[model samples]
Target: MALRGLPTPLPGLAISSLLLARPAIAHDHHGGSEIPEGQTVSVEPLDTTLWIHIFVNMFAYGVIFPIGMITKSRWHVPTQIVGSMLALLGFFLGHAHGGREFVGNNVHGLFAHILQILLIAQVVLGLYLKGHWEKGINGFIRKLIRPCHSIIGKAMPVLSWTQMIFGGITALGFCQGEYTGQCAAHFIMGSAFIAYGILLTIILLVGQVWMRQTGRSQEFYDSAVIAAWGCVNTFTEHHWGTAWVRNDWQHTSMGIIWWCAGLAGIWMSRDRDGNPKRNFIPGLVIAITGWAMSSHPQELMVSEATHKMFGHTLMAAGLTRIIEVAFILGDKQSLTEDGRTWNSFQFLPIFLLYTAGFLFMGATEEQMLLVAGSDMDHVAYILILFSLASLVFLFANMLVHMYDRLANPTSSKEMNGYTGVNGRPMEEGRIRDAEEFELEGLTSDGEADDEGRGMLRRSQEGHRSQIQGVPLR
Candidate 1:
C-alpha cells in the first residue's frame, strides 16, 4: 500500500479499498501469483485517473446516448457535445499511463492502443456528422453517416466494456514491480454486467419487433426467468463476511437453485397455448433479484454512502414495472424493450440503475475520494449533470408516451385479432364515417396532434426537430 505518483481507480488507494465486496486494489494487498520470471513490469496502476476516465465513459455510453437516441430532442446534440469532452479528458489520462504495463515480456500494449485509436475515429466521425457539407455530396455524406454512426455507436461501447474487462484483469496494465492477480470475483462480475447489457439489448430489440408483428410477449417471460436465475446466484453464492470462506462448498447450490427456478418459471408460464404473457412471475423475479443484489448496506458512510441505494434504484424500477402490470396501468409491454413508447417509461429504473452504477463506480473508490480527487469528482458531476439534462428530455418523452406508446391506442385487437385466415385479420371494406374512428393521437396529416392541450399533448412533438435544417439522428 505505497503512496506514489497519481492515484488510480477504485481498488488501489492507501485507505481500505472495497469495490462490490471484492478488492481490485493493486499488488501488495494480496500477493497475487506471478507471471513468468521474464515478464514483470515496473509500471504503476492509474487507479485515480481511471476513476474519472472509465466512469465517465460508462455514463456517457450507457445513459446519455440512450436518452438522446430515444427522444431525438434538442438536447441530443448537446449530449454528444458533453460526452465528447469527457472522452477527451479520459484519453488524456489514459495516455498518462505511458504503456507502463507492457514494459515486461508479456505486452498487451498493442491491443490497448488499437482500441484507443478506434475510439478516436468514432469521435471524429461523430463530429464530422455535425458539420454541414455541400448539397449534392451532403446526401451521400448522410448515407455514409447513417451506417457509420449506427455501427460505430454500437461498437465503441461494447469495445469500451471489453477494455474495462481487460483493465480489471491486468489491474489497468500496471503494478508495482511484481503482480500476482486481482481477485477473480471482480472479473466475473464485470463479465456478468457485460452479459447483462448484451442480453438486455438483444431481448429488447427482439421483443420490440415481435410485439409489433405477432403481439405475443415472449421477451418478458424469458427475461424474467433469466433475472430469477441471476438472483438465485446472487443471494446464495456471494460469500459476504468480514473474513472466511464458510460456504465454499455451497457455491454450486445457488446455481442449481437458479436453474430449477428458471426452468420451472418457463414450464409453468405455459397454459397449453404456447402464449408468453400469461404469467408475470418472470418479471417479478427479475425485479426482486435486481433489488436484492443491490441491497447490501455499507458499514461506513464516508466513501460509498449510497452504494446500496444505487442497486436499490434499479430494483425500484423493476418493482414499479411489476406494479404497472399488476394494476394494469398502461405499462403492459416487454419491460426491457429498447424502443421508445409509453411502456418504455416503465424501463426507466434500469436506465437509472446503470447511470447510478457509473456514478458510484466513480465517486466511491477510496482512491478516487482522496485529497485532490477533484478531477474524479468533476467527472462524476458532469456525468450526473448530463443525466439530469437528459432526464428533462426523457420526462417529456415519457409524458408524451404515457398512454399506448406501444400500439395505437384506438386500434382494435379484433382488427388485428384472431378472427381472420392464418391469424391475419382482413381490413374492413371502408370507414362509413371517418370521424367516428378518426384515431386517438393523430391529425389527418399523419402527424401527432400537437395543438391539443394537456400533459400528453403538451409533451408531444408533431415531428422530430431539425438541426440547422438537417434531420437529427
Candidate 2:
C-alpha cells in the first residue's frame, strides 16, 4: 500500500513536465466573452526571464526555505543563505521580464514590493541572530528582536504562497470585475483544502507527540474550524434581501450541512472519560458536499464534466477518510503502537483532497470555457491539473523528509539497531548532540553557572521530547 500510494503524485509531475515542454497553442484572441477588456490570455508561453524567475523562487520558497525552517543542523544557515540569494535573483528577473506587459495596475507587481521588503527584513534579523551578540545595548537589541525573527521567518512561506498565486492570476489576467467572487471562492477554498492536506501530512509524519499533548482529538480542531467556516459561508454565500439563485441555494445548503455536521463532530470528539476520540462527521460532511456539487448545473459540456470530476474526487477523499478512521485505524489515534508508523491507506484521503482542490480551482467558468474553445477535452485537462497537484505534493513530502533527516540525523541507524560509541542507541546520541548544539549557541561563554546550565538543559530536553516520535524519512 505504501509503495502504491506514495508514488501516486509523481507520475503526474513527470507527465505534466513533458506536456508543459510543448509549445502552447496560439489563439488569435482569448475565447471567452467574459474576458475583461485589455486582459490577455496565456495563449503564448511565458518569456524566458519570467520562467526562470518563477522556477527560482518556487525552488527557494516552495522547497529550500520550508526545509530550513524545520531543521536544526549546521546546514540550516547555508540553506537559508542560498534560498535568500535565489529569491533576490528571482525578484530581479520578475521586474526585468520583457514578455507581454500588464495593461492595468498590477496587483502582482504591487505585492512583490511588499514581499521584497519583508524578505530584506527577514535577512537582516537572521544576520543579527547569527551574530550572537551577548554584551551591551547590542545584546539587548538582539534579545528583543529574536522572537520577531522567528515569527517572520515562519510567516515568509505563507506570504510567498499568496504572492505566487497573485503572479499566476496576473499572468492569466483573472479575478477581474464580476468574476472576482467566483475566482476568490475557487482559489481560496482550493488553497484551504491543500493547507488541510499539509496539516494532515505533518500530523501523520511527525506530530503524534504534539497530538498527545493537546489532550483533544484531531477531530476537535477539524470540526471547530468546519463549523466556523460553515457559519461564515451560510451568511456570506448569498446576498440578503435578494432572490436566491440556484448556486446561492446550493452553496447555502452545503454551508448548513457543514455547521450541523461540525457541531456533531465536536460533540463526539471525546469519550466519556474525556479522552480524545475519533468521529466520522467531518468525512461525512465532505462526502455530502461532493455529492451536491457533482450535479451542479453548467451551460458548457466541459464545465459539466469538470465539475463532476471535481465532485467525484472530493467524494473519494471523504470516503477514504471514513475508511481510514472506521476500518483502518478502528477509530484510534494511530494504527501503530508507538504512533510512529502509519498504514499507506492513510495517504489516500490526503492526496485525494489535494487532487480535488486543483480540480475545483481549475473548473472555474472562464477556465472551462477557455478549455472548450481550445478543443481540449475534460480528461486531458483534468490529468494536467492532477499533474500539478502531484508535483506540489511531491515537493511537500520532500521538504518534510528533508527536515526529518536533518533534525534526527541518527534515527535511521538507531531504527536498524545500531549503537553509538557510548553504547547508547543513536537516538540518545541525537539528543546529546542537540543538547550540545543548543548549549553552545545559548551560552556564549564556555562556562556557565550550574543554575543557568540546568535551565538550558531542561529547555533543550523539553524541545527534544516534543519531536521524539518517528522520523518521516
Candidate 3:
C-alpha cells in the first residue's frame, strides 16, 4: 500500500538527503554534521534518558493537551500549564542526551524550538482571553484572538505528532539517503491511517448530526480521498524513464486497484432516489491491500514478521468496518440513540486501525533492525506498539466524551434523574402510565358513559361487600 522507495513531496526527504549526502567530518552551519564519505554510522540505541524524554513529551502533547482543549474552561488553563511544563522539561532533556551527539542544525532540535514557541504563543493567547475585557479596544482584540487561540490549541497536538515522528527518526539516525523516500511513504501513510481512525471516531461520537447534514454517506468522503491518493501513487511510484522493477510494479498496481475500488465506492454510495447509501467497497479495498501487504516479500525475517502483523491488523480493521456498516448498523448510519452511547461493537474497527497504523510505522527497515538487535522479539515489539495504540485510543475516546458532555450539558429532566441521548429523557414507565390514564377523559357518548358507570357500580359493590366482611369471589 506504500510507495516503497519513491521520492515524496514531504520536506523530510530533503532534510534526510542533506544529512546523508556527505560525511560527518565537519558541521554544515545550518545542517547537521555528516559521517565520513565512505564510513557508515550505525543506528544509535535509545538510552534511559531518551526514553524518559520520549514518554514525558508524548504524554504531555498526546494526553494532557488534548484533554485541556476538550475541557476549554478553567480546568483548561491548569491542564495546559502542566502539559507545557512537562513539554519544556522534555525539550531540555532532548538536548542533554549523551548517547547521541547531533552536530550542526538538528532537525529534531529545530522542530522542538518551533513547537515551544507555538506553545508559548498558545499560553499567552489563553491568558489574554481569560481576562474577560469588555467595552474597549482590548475587548475587540480579545474577540479577534479568541478564534486564533482555539485554532492553535487544536493544531498543537497534530504538530506535536509530527515532531514526535521526527524525534524518533532523528534519534535512530534513520531515514537517510536512499531510505528517505521509503520513510516518507511509511510515515505519511501510517499517519493517514491514524487520522482516518480518529475521524471515524469523531463522526461516530459527536459528528452524527453534521454527517447527516452532509447528505452523503461516509463512504463518499473515504472514496474521494482514496481515489485522490491512488492517483498520486500511480504516477509517482515509478520513474517513467527508468526500468520498472518488481517493487514499482507492485506499488503501481496497488494504486491502480485503489482508484478503481474508490470510484466504485463513490458510485455505490447513493440509491436510485439519490439518497445517501452505505457501501462496502472501501472496506473491501482495504482488505485486499492488507492481504497484498501481508504477502509482500521482505529481505529480513524481522521485517517480514512486522509487515505480516501490520497487514493482519489492517485486514482486521477493514473486516470489522464492513461488519459494523453492514451487519451491526444494517447498512445504515447508526443505531437507536437514547443516549450518546455507541454500540460496543463499533469501537473494534477504530482501535484496530489505530493499532494498524502504529504497526506499519514500526515496520520500517531501520526500526525493525533496531528491534532485532534488542532483547525483545517481534511479538514483544508488536505488543508494545499495540499498547501504545490502546493508550491513544483511550485518550481519543475520553476527549470526545468530554466534548459531548460540554456540548450537551445536563437538562432539567436529566437533573431530575432522567437522561438519554440528545438530551431526551428515558421512556422506561411512560407507556404504561399513559395506558393506565388513557380512558379517563373518554366520555363522548352513551356507550362510553354506560361503561364508566358500570365500572363505578362494580367498585361500589366491591366496597360494600368488603364492609360486610363477605368473601367476594
Candidate 4:
C-alpha cells in the first residue's frame, strides 16, 4: 500500500529553522553532527535566493556558449559547454545545500562568475587541442581567424584574473556572517585561482621574451606557444577542481611539471649561436626538476589519502611526459642528399615505455586505493590517467607523422632559359649584357637611323676585333 502522506523538507523555511536552532545545540554538545544543528529553518526564502544566483550564472554561461560556437574553434566549443554544465551543477548544489548568498545576488557578480568560467574553459580547451585546432581549420580560415582569435585569446587570461578579483569581493561581502568553514574553503579556492592566473600571465610574458630572443623561426615559435598553452591548461584544471576539497593535488602538480618541461624543451631547441649542447643540459635539469618536485612528498604528510592521490597524479604526469619526449626524439630530422627524412619510427620504443609506465602506475594506484578503502578516489585517478594516456598515445603518433612530413623536402623545378612569371628563369648575366648593349646603342645612335646603323656596325666590329685580337673592316 502507498503511504497516504509523508512530509518532505520545505526549502527556505527548513534552512532558516536550522540556522535558528544551531546555536542552541552548540551548548548541548554531542560534538555536533555532520549537518549543522540549531536554527529556525525556513524553506521558501532561501530557495528564492538560491534560484536567483543560479539563473544569473546560467544566463551568463549561456551567452558565452554561443560566442564560442560562432568562433568555430571546435576545441573551445566543447569546453564552453562542459564548463557551463559544471557551473550549472554547482549553482544547483549550492542552492539545494544552502550557500547561495555566498556567491552574491548582484547582477555584476553573476556576470563576473560567468566570465570566469568562460575564460577558464576556453584556456583549457585551447591548450588541450592546440596542435589539432591549428591543423583542423581550413588554411584560409586559419589565416583570417587567427589574428582575431589571438586578440580575444590574449584577453581571456586577463579577464579570468579580473573575474577572480571580483569573486574575492563577492566572497568577502557575502560570506561575512555566513558559514565560516564554507567561507574558508571559498577563500582557499579563490587564492588558487589567483595564483594560477598570475602563473598564466607570467607564461605569456615569458613566451614573448623567448620569441624576441629567438627570432622568427616557426619551430622555435611553435614550441614556445605550445609551452605557454600547457601552463594555461594546467592552471585551468586546478581551478576546476578547487571547489571540491577532495581533489588530488598530485594531479595538479603533474600538470605544472608538464608545463615546465614544455618550456625547457622550447628553450633547449632554440638556435643558440654557440655551444647549444650546454642549453640541453640545463633544459634536461629543468625537466627532471619539475618531475621530481611534482612527485615530492610535501602534502603526503598531511594524510594517507593525500599521499595516494598525489602519487597517482605524479605518476600519470611522468608517464605522459615520457611519451612526449619519445615523440620528440622519434621526430628528429635526418639529412640526406635529396633533403631530410624524419625517422619517427624511432619513437616506438618510447611509446611502448609510456604504455607500460601508465599501466604500472594505474595498477599501483588501484592497489593503494584498495588498501586504503578509497575505491572511488582510485577509480577517478585511473580514469584521468587513462584519458591522458590515450591522448598522449594518439597525439604522439600524429605528431611523429606530421614532423616527418614537415621535414621531408620537395624538389624545386628546373629553370628554363626564357623568362616569365611562373614560367622560366631569366639569367641575370644575360639580362645585364643585353641591357648594356641597348644602352650603348641608344647613346651612340641618338635616334638617327643612319647614324645608329653606323654606330651599331662599329660597335660590333670593335667587340669582334677585341675578341679576335685583330682590327675589323
lDDT of 4 by residue, 342-369 (tens): 2344333333333333433233222343
Ranking by lDDT: 3, 2, 1, 4
Model 3: what TM-score?
0.78
Worst 10 residues of 4 by lDDT: 1-10
What's the residue-level lDDT of 188 in candidate 3?
A: 66
RMSD of 4: 20.5
Better of 3 and 4 by TM-score: 3
TM-score: model 4 vs. ground truth: 0.31
Model with the higher lDDT, candidate 1 or 3: 3
Candidate RMSDs in Å, in order, are 14.6, 9.2, 13.1, 20.5
lDDT (tens digit, per residue) of candidate 2 on 218-313: 899989888877787677667899998777777787778788889999999999998899999889888887787787777888888888888898
In Å, residue 8's CA in model 3 sits off its true spot by: 7.4
* Model 2 lDDT at residue 406: 55
Cα RMSD of predicted structure 3: 13.1
Tell me how far the alpha carbon of residue 451 in candidate 2 is from the true structure, in angstroms, after superposition: 14
Estimate the lDDT of model 1. 0.43
Please report how far candidate 4 places residue 259 from its true position, in Å: 14
